[model samples]
Structures are given as C-alpha cells and as structure tokens.
Target: MEQAESLALPALLAARAARNGDAVLFSDRKASWSGAQALEIAARRAGALAAHGVRRGDRVALLCTNRSEFMEIVLGCGWLGAVVVPINTASRGMQLEHILRNSGARLMVAETHLVGAVHAIDAQTHALESIWLIESGEGGETHNRSGAAAAGASVAGTPAAGAPAMREIAVWPLPPLGEPLAAPCIGDGDALAILYTSGTSGLSKGVICPHAQFYWWARLTAGHLGVVPGDVLYTCLPLFHTNALNAFFQALVSDAQLVADRRFSASGFFASLIETRATVTYVLGAMVPILLGRCASAQEQAHRVRIALAPGVPGHFQQEFTERSGIALLDGYGSTETNFVLGGGVADQRAGYMGKLVPGFDARVVDDNDREVPDGEAGELILRADTPFAFANGYFGMPEKTVEAWRNLWFHTGDRVVREASGYYRFVDRLKDAIRRRGENISSYEVEQVLLSHPAVETAAVYAVKSEFAEDEVMAALVLREGAALDALALIRYCEPRLPYFAVPRYLDFVADLPRTENGKIQKYKLRETGITTTAWDLETSGYRLRRT
Candidate 1:
C-alpha cells in the first residue's frame, strides 16, 4: 500500500480520491460515500461552514452522535484549516458548559434531539453565536443559515419558560451545502481536532491533535491489525472518541472500507458484522465479557471477523473469547493524547500484557520522581514520540496543564505499569484520580465536588472500585453534616441531573468522618483499599435505575 504525500487530511483525501475515486471509503446508518464523493462532501461542508463565519483557526463544536455528518464536519474542518471540537454526546451540566466556553466555538452543529442540552446552557456562559440543529435521518440542505428558513428548514422551538432565554444565539436547521471550497495548503502540524479528556484533579482538558498524530495512528494501527486493501473495517464505538476516528484513518490510508454503526449492540453485534462483511473489528475490555456472557449462537461463529483490536480484556478471558468466537483479541495500549505507542500484531501478543512498545515511540517505566525503574517494578509509564507531530500538541488554552503533563520532555501517561525482562508491559493501576467505567473516563475530583454540593454532605471522597466487568466503578465515601439526614438514593437523585449517568456513584458509603492526612487532605488510597464494604449502599441492588439520556 502507498502512503499519502503528507499526513494532512486534505492530502490524505486527495490521494485516496485520486487512487480510487469509485472505491467506498465510509458508511454509517445515514449514507455511504466513495473516496471522490467523500472529498466533494467535505468540500461542500467546508463551504457551508465558511458561509457561517467559521474561518481558519476558528473552533467549531460538534455535539452529535455517530452519523455521516460527524465525519463530514470533521473532514470539512480539517480541509478548511479550521479546528473541530467534538464534544461527547453524553456531556451535560458543568462539563458541557466548560467545553463550550473553553473551546470558544462560535458555531455548533448538534442533533435536534440533543438540542435540550444547548438550551440548558445559558447563552452568556458560552461563546456560541449560532446552532445548526440536525433532525433525525435528515441531512440539512447545502444553503446558508439565512436561506435555511426559506428552504423549508424547520426552526427549533423557543426555550421552555424559566429557562435562560438564549435569544442571542440564532437557531436554524442544518444548513445546506454551499459552493464546494478548494482545499488549502495544510501542513502535517496543523490542528485537526480538540478532544476533551478528563483531568485527574480538575476539569477536562482539550487535547489538540495534529494531522500527523492521526496519520501515524492509522498507519501503525492498520499495520498492527494487518488490514489489507478492500478489507471491511467496522466499529461501534462513538465517533467522538479517538479510537473510532482513527479507524476512519486506517481505512483512508489503506484502500479499505469503513463501516461505523451508531452504537454498540451486544445482541446484534455479530449480525451487523456479518452484514457489513467486516474482516476486522474493535471492542473494549468491558465489551468482550458482555459478549461472552450471552448464550452461544450461530451468529458468533458465522462472521468472517478474524481479529479485533480489543484492549483492556481480562487476561483469562482472552483465550475463552477467541475459542468461542474464532476472533483473536489483540491487547494494546494507546490514549487520546497519544498514538498507537504500544501493541503488536495478533501473532505477537501475551495474554494479559500490553504488547511491547511499538517502534518510532519511546516508553519508560519511571518512579514518582521521574527516575527509571528496574524491570518488574511498577512505575508511571511515560512516553515520547520519535517522529514529529506523532503525539498531541498539548492541552488547548491550558499552558500549565500542558507543561505538567508533558514535563521533563516526556508525555506522562499517569498509568502505573511494570515491564517484564522480556519487554512486555503489565498494567498495574491508574496513578491519577480518574475512573474508567463503561469506557468513559470519569474525574474523581469532579464527582467529589458534586457530592459535596449537597447541603447535607459536609465532606466527600470519590474513588474507583473494581467492577465485575474488569473496569473501574465510581464509588464515593461521604460524611454527613451534623444533625443532617440523607439517604444514598436521594444523593444519587440529586446527582442524576448534575452529572452523567455513568459518573454517578454506583456505591455510596455514609461515614462519620473520612480518612485524612496530617495536613487534613483526604487519603483516597485508603478508601480505595476498603472498597464496597458490607454497609455501603449499592445502587445496582437498590432497584433504582439511572436515566441515560
């Protein structure tokens, strides 16, 4: 397979179009597009964005779910030299406001169903000047916002009474395609997207990814998965995530086809794979166990899927999953802020270990003071890229965080790992106060803040506990105020609107006091050690369900 002249999105699209214009490149529930058609769609989307005052270097926020428009907006922004900020569809309350404010996005394109989130955000709190709402199954016309009403575009209803009157920002149907804009001279280092990642001790930070990081991500990932031309690559992960986004690049760089579903459905997973003729697929560690738990069916063995980029799978389940489904799971390590830095081909992986460091990237197991630790000793895994623009530039609009994470000339992963004498790395635990549940990164500090907001709660300590699915579960230890009474269910109810459904603590413990240090700082490690005591309130057994909107 040949590579593009450069790693820029425009160059990649142009080269792919030139090589095989008629070959299908992308498909979702909305539509499918070939290489040339995809480029043309991107050009037209760029024209529409430019007509709405989105210029080069300006940020455009996307709050839609998995759809062709998601890819269109992303590719359009890249082609036009603008930056796209893809917000998590589940984002709400303080997190949503912070992203909109921090990104400084003047124009937002969101699904109509999720427009309530925008209405909930006070216009004064965000930089949005306009919102283009996309209705279900309908891709808006190619006209400007001014002409949208006349073109029969549906206008969004006014905000509900008592809600902030967001009259300052205009609401229009998804704009029509404008005149096709030509690609500019984009470089490998140009910002492609800003993906927000949860911070350990603070709010989430936007990771400024350049063109080359994804270029290397796709090239290396495709090689590791052994993707060949004409192979069908399918993923059910959300498009806002780096994994699914990088899958698109894998198809673009190699002459393969990409099939992205709206979301992962455990029941229909194998059916969809068979229908899409997928030869390669992706799954999270949590997903593997769910699939294995289901009763054996013919569909599991009927698919042609030979390999899956399955990360975080329990070591013991690896062989069981392959034996049941005939698809080998390849365990690897990568993050939104980094590329495919570790992992290898299917034939070269240890059961539970993250594969050895990939070539072109440097990895070190270091102590807390940044000193290198000997093999078999657990330490923070820090990494550096050998190639230029192969990792994220840094956190956008936050220089202090950028320096802190990228200090000492290495990007700190904040993950604890131990390297074996043979060079394989075993995962230990997270050094940062972040929790991973259902593939979503939850900030423990943010959860603690929410718990503390309740008037009855005087102190709160939020941390992670092991879930049955081999992922982290949010657990909170709370201290009530004097003469105050609050049940765990009531606190969860208070948190439902204030936090994402997943961030709400599944296990809550009401204590007289929390463990603290001499300086009065909370010692979270001690709390993590005594996870889910018998007296703790368990939401799973409480019969109350969280509404995942």
Candidate 2:
C-alpha cells in the first residue's frame, strides 16, 4: 500500500483516507471536503502549523486568494513537514521583497486584504515571522494602505504599523482547527512546494518541489487528462501557478473532484463550467484567446466539460476551441521544473504538438553546444527524469541558479522546441522569447499566433524592441475587443499577411491589459521594460513598407 510513488503528502493523505473515506475530495466557492474530510483537514491544518511555531523544513509564506484557506495551507504544509511558499497573489514591491527574502518564510498566511501587501514590505527586508489574517475586513483588522483600520488594531495581537526597517511584525488572527496533528515522518523525496518562477527573465526562482514532484504531477496530469474517479476537475488557474497547483494534485491522485476558481472569469466562464460538473478542465496560453474572445454564449456549448489541460494553447486556437467549447483542448509540455514531461491521452493528441516523450522522461533537442539538435531542427529543451525525485529539487536558495539550471545532467528547458520526425514536440520560442528581426528569427510564439488570429485581437503580447539596426524589433502588446477599435495601421496590415515580412509588428502597444504574471504569465519583462512608449505605434516612423510575399 505504500506505492503511490513512495507516498508523501503525509502518506498521500493516508492513502486517500484509506481508500475514499466518503469520496468527495475538495471544492471551493466556500466548502465541501471528504477523503475523510481531506484527511481531517490535514490534521487540523497540522495543528495550526504546530501552534504557529511551524517546524519540519519550515518556510510557510502563502499570500492567499483561491480559498478553502488556500487548501488548508497546502494541506497544512504537507501535513506539517513544512515548505508551502505559494505567493503570487499578484506579489508586489521588489517582487514582494524577493519572495519574502528568498523564502526564509517564517509564517505568512496573508489575505485580510493581503495584509496591505505585507505592510508594504521592508520589515528588515523579509523573513516575515508573523502575519496570519485570512478573515477579510474589520474582524481580521490589519488594513493600512489607506483601506483604514490601524489605530490600535482590533483582532489578534497587532503591532503591525508600517513594518519598516528593523522590527514590529506580529499581526495574527487566522488560527482555529487546531488539535489533530499526527502524520509526520515524511519522504518521497521531501521538499513539497516552493514554486515561484514567472521571473520572466530575472529574480523569481524557488522551484524545489519534491514529494515525488507532486506525485509525478498528479500521476502524469491525471494520465494526460482522462482523469477518472467521479471526474469534475475545473480550475480558474491560480492556486499560485504550476498550473493551478497541479490542479490540486490532479484532484488528489485522481479520485477527482477539485473545482477551485477564485479568478479567471470570462463572464463567469460557462457558468462555472456548468456549476462544476466539470469533467476535467484547466487552461493557460492566454486562456485560449480569452475564451475565444467571448460573445458566442448559450454558455458556449453548455457544460459537462470533457477535456482541457490546455498548456500554452494556439494551434489555431485548438480546433476553434474544440469547435466552440464541447471542451477538448489538450496540448502539453510542463515546467515548474517539470513533470507530466510532455503529454497525450485524448487519444494521444497532436494538433500543435508538445506530446510524445513521456515514458519516464529523457528528452533532448539541444544545440547551444549541449549537442543533439537534428530531427526538425529548433533547439534547447533538455529534460531527464526517469523518476527518482521526479524533477525539481534545486534552485531554492539558488545555489548558482541551481548549478546554472542543472548543468549537464539536463533539465534546462529554457524552452524552444521542434522534434517532429512524427514524435511531435513543436513549440518554438522562449529561448528567452526569441525575436531577432531584420536578420529574421522572430517566433514570439509565431508572432503571438499572428496577433491572435486578428478579429479585433483581445490580448497579444509579442515582444523584443532594441532595433535601430542593433537587432531585435517586433514589439506588439495589443488587447482590443471591448468596443473594439484596432488600427495600429490596421494592426500592421493584419500582420502583413500572417507574418514573416520580418514578423510584422514593428511596435504597436494598444493595451488596456497585458503585463500579467500572477499566473496569467505574459510579463514579457514588463514589455521589455516599457520600451518604445511615446504612445507606441512606430512601424519605421509610420512609413510602412513590407514587400516580400
């Protein structure tokens, strides 16, 4: 019985509470639990993180949003062996003081309106040491970034003024569900959760993971989206990333029933996937063109959703979003330091590749001298796995960026793909988001899928700027469709016939959004540090001339 990949989240919640202790599993818009009430709320949230002085490999952090007390502090920091760290509630200042000082964590639960972005950081730079909140307005108190409540605070212990340089941190409140604590001696390669990376070219590393890398990312993404047992997986993407925290470990090792939501609402996404009867769901890649630029409703083919996984979608919006939402999106490839290594299952999917290469992992693609690279050419993918710690056990306190991204024994994945001798793969771009111009090379994901197949484009991005012959130029940042107008020279003559006249967009802008990263990605290094902005638009100073057709 100890084989769920060497069990870890406190023996995988005591073997799913000894085989489905009253089934259910988890839900969100407030409640619902089961598997013996999620193993008795992971032992009363591991006895309220050991009465606040958290222990095992410590590091707590969790800046809330997406509730059920953020999955009971990630199952009470994996039933008290401790490591959680979730963050990205749209972080803040110096990337929330470099993730609370590179996760030295020291107890941070958050969400009484995000503890005023942790009392505006700088409490001697970080390693927090207090804050619990989660109560939401007045009773949980701690407000201050002008949303009121700081005069001799009203709940817990307080001491939280403007956490300046050397001290005063405290702030309490979120405690109850205390005495239950049992499951301790953990393993399955320990470290369960550190996450972090949407650094989008800098700072955010963290990774670590282990606990058999989220039990092989919920047994290879619930066996590539055919997640079974009582099905229902939904996810409005943002349990602080790793694709909605591995869709809550693929509905806890597939006894399936997750529902999460606390975000992504393209007009309440098909009435919350028809009131969560969600037969496996989850999205990303500009949420499939923002639910295919909204408007077609009758809740877009109503619900009982069938399939979704959807990693970076856009192979012509995956068959017009599975023919306008009878679900089925698929596509793959993974990364919070890998697992679900590539994908398959909706009868081994293909349209827009990323699959083939899963059997206990080991990939290649190479070329910036790490060799390999031949099949269909593009390079840099790497990988390795064969299971052990499954994949990520490095980059926490960044030991030289985890030996420069796991040096030779592979794991690089700075991404760039193309394998194809029918073994699939495809995805070309993000080898630091490639875009050379004039000397060609572009693919900012194929010019943001030809500026998201135009029709008043609602969310493009496509980057790279520097050119004055110094190289890179493309640029884009769009977002139109709400009373849509579009004309940055008619979106560069609709990307000069679907791109390649030097990948069209010689700078555009139009934004009302797109600088994402709290798990909706697209932070193209803050639009390459807000580069050509004198109200953008340029195209070689408006003279426009692309000929090569």
Candidate 3:
C-alpha cells in the first residue's frame, strides 16, 4: 500500500478489505467487525447518512464514547466526504455548545449516557437540525425501553420544516450491509475530522485534519511500532483525542486488528491487556505511574504486548516500567497539529529525550523572532512537514489562528525544548500557559473563563502549578465580589457540571486581588510564582471526588 497515504479513507478501506476480506478488524464488548464487514457497514451507514440529507462537506459531530461504532460512523462520513467532528466526552455546558456552533455540524451522534450533556448545548447557537442519539444501555435516558423504533423524533423549538431533527438509534447499531458507494470526488486532501484542541487563547480551537493527515499518521506510527498483519493494537484512551485515532490509523494501514475498550481503568488495565492479548498500545502521562502503583498482577506479565508508545513518560518511571513489565516504553513528542515528529527506536530510545526528528518534517528550536536557537539552548520548537497536509490543514474557522500558527513557514508548537549537541531533543516546558494534567491539555484561559462565570467571583487568574509527579495541577487565584460569602468548595461544586473534570481547579486561593501589568492584563507568571500557599484550598483534602466517566 505505497499509495496508501494518497488514498482517501474509503479507498483505503476498500483496498484492505479486498486483500483480507475475512480478517478480523475492529473489536469491542459488543462485537467484532471483519475487514469486509467493516467496509459493508461503513457503506450502509453512508447510505443512512445520505438518506438523512448529509451531503458532501457536511459536518457530522460524534459525542459517543470509546466504541467501534464511533469508527464506523467516522468511516461512513469519510466515504461520504462529510467532515467528522469528535467532541470530548468530558465537555459540557458552554464547551459542548462552542464546538457544535464552531464546526457548524448539521447532525450529532451522541450516546445515551451523554444526553444530559447535550441538553446543556445552546440550541440557538447553530443551525444544527438533527441529533442521532445512540443508546448506551437498556435504561439510559434516551433509550426507549418499550422496544420501539421510529423514523425520527421531534425536538423542542425545532422548525417543523428546517430545524434540526433529534432521533434515537440503538447503541452500536449495525446498518444493513450493502454495496459500498463510490466517492471518486473524495480525495486525500478532503477534510475528515475537526479535533478540538485547547489554545493559548482560552477557547478551544478545532484543528482541521484531512484524510491524508490520518493516513500518514497511521503509516508512520505503525512503522515505528513495527506492526504486522494479525497484530492486535489496543488502546483504552478516549477516541475523542488524536492519540487513539492515530492508533486506529495504525490498524487500518497495517492490516492489524484493533481492540478498543470503553475507557482507561488503572486498576483493570493489565487484566484488559491480557484479555485482548494486545501486542502494542499507547500509555500517556500519568497512566504509566498509575499502572505501576497497582499491585503486581500476573496478568501484567501474561500479556503478549511488546511495546507501548509512551509520549510523556518520565525517565525514572520509563526505566522501572520497562524492567518490571518486560515491555519497552518508547518515548516521543508531538501534538494535535502534528503527529509524532520525533522519536527513537526501542533499541536506542533515551529517557526524557524526544529522539531525532521523524522523517517528512523539518524541526528547529528558535527564538521569538523565529531565528534558530543555538544547540543546547532552550527555545520554542517549530516544525514544517516535507509532505503536504502531513500535519493538520489548519484551525477550523480561524484563519487568523491558522496563519499565526503557521507563520514563518513553520508550525509553531509553542513548546520549549533543548536540542543538544548529541542531536537529541529534550522537552523543557510549555511556552504557552497551558496545563497538562493526566493526559488532557487544560487551557488556563478556558478554566479561568469557567471560574469567572460563577456569581461570587470577581477576578480570577488560573495558572499551572507543578504536580508532585509530573506535568501540572490547575490552580486558581480568585478575588470574590465585595461582601461575597463563598468558599472554595462551594465554587468548585458550582463548576462541577460546567467544566470537564480535568479542568476543575485542584488548588484554589481567594486572594485580596490579582497582580496585573501596566496594560491591565493579569500576570499569570506572578500567580504561578506565588506557589501553593497554606491558605490554598486543596480539593483532595476538601473531600471533593471527581467521577471519571
């Protein structure tokens, strides 16, 4: 499949299915799809979407959890030349509304458990005319427990003629298999997905990824993992993010099967791995430590997994996990815009060093003016791909952001790194004031926006405080309204439903006021430097527990 990178998703699937029709392709608790079966399902779904008036270039947003059906719908959209917008399951309130409006999605496919979150979306913000609710369980809110089916369901305030239609479909429903439709017009450059990523500007920006982006993402990462036919690529990471999508690409391109689970559970991870007999997977950020903290399970050693594409593992933990599990932890560095741009083979991988730049891209550490920094000096890492559309096309609906990011002919990563004389690059810090908690990128601006929405809050400055393990813990310094009587716990409870679990501030301080610059902008550097004072409200100690769905 040398021309695989140039083939659109539909063409890629056809090629694979023809060569290995009966091969097992995708799996979940519900069922497994074969190579031929996957293509048939995708085609029927494409037909279903067409019947729903989803046409070329139309955007279909998916808010379902980690299930094979998500991939099925994505592939269907790909075949129809429709853009697939994956919404973060953790997002609710304004965050959910923003993505739908920003992407201008005509239809949404969300699971039953997520109906409450969808209820929070502002119906007036966009021209969304339809919602295809997928039943998650027998007793979910949107599920019709009376064993009923319907053509469509009426939504409140929807126009009788043109307003969005809301309909419920079964969880992981399989449309009738039929002849796959041909989309000769859909090419590699056609838009495939709009992955929402946190920006330095607080509000999340949707990164437009073309079909070619995912194709190469799979081929390259699959090569790095040494994937072969019959290999089982496993990932419990949510499909909303690029990491798992890349893993999905690996399976599609390399003729490997994919075992996608519902979500990551640190306690049951090893057991899951053993059950899947996975050969390769991904472990990001604190997951490595969390897995290590578990009691030594026989299942850990029983799994056939050989390598884990750990992008952000600390050096000491990398060594310990490798030694203990007898599985190699390969470290690399990348972001949503660009897939992995740097890495090393397991034979030569270095702890904390992000290895040499991957082929098909040019990378440099540069100063503010875009001048290349001297080796061994800390500076912003910028990358330019040799192949066209290898990185994200740009930020959706934000040409200014796209232009600003691609300035000076390089995709500015806003990450601090040091290129040593030995030619290995080590991550230093995030130049942008973003926080990485667990594996999620928390925009300080977004978090602060939520905090400011509270009635008692007057001024809020949210910043990242270094976590004891690694990455960051979100901290907020707030100045309450005059005579306002509110506690940190109360404000947090207020933000519980409004913000994602990861975005909620773990440490809160109600200061007299915030430090500002002459331009009247809050100086977050000063707040971060203030560190955690004794008065800071510790959410963990305050008995606040977050339920991760």
Itemize residue pairs with steric clashes in candidate 3.
Answer: 129-164, 129-165, 130-164
- Which parts of model 1 have CA positions greater than 4 angstroms off? 1-3, 137-167
Q: Which ten residues in a row have the lowest lDDT in candidate 2?
A: 151-160
What lDDT tens digits, residue by residue, belong to model 3 across residues 262-324? Answer: 888888887788888899988887888888887786777888999999988889898888877
Estimated TM-score for each candidate: 0.94, 0.30, 0.93
Q: Return the TM-score for candidate 3, rounded to 2 decimals.
A: 0.93
466-531 in candidate 2: lDDT tens per residue?
A: 753325677888888889787788778766644436567778888788878788977788788778
**Candidate 3 ranges beyond 4 A from true positions:** 1-5, 138-151, 157-179
Candidate number achieving the greatest TM-score relative to the actual structure = 1
Q: What lDDT would each prediction earn against the true structure?
A: 0.88, 0.76, 0.82
lDDT of 1 by residue, 1-549 (tens): 233568899889989999988999999956999999988988999999998889999999998888888898998999899999999887877788889999999888888666566666566777787788777543333223323333133333234457764446677778878899998899899999999989576899999999999999999999999999999999999989999999999999898999999889999999999999999999999999899899999999999999999989999999999999999898899999998888999888999899999988899999989999999999999999988899999999999999999999999999999999999999999899999998889988788878888999999998999988989899898899999999789999999877878899999988988889999999999999988888889999999999876
- Ranking of models by lDDT: 1, 3, 2
Which pairs of residues collide in candidate 1?
A: 141-176, 141-177, 142-176, 142-177, 143-176
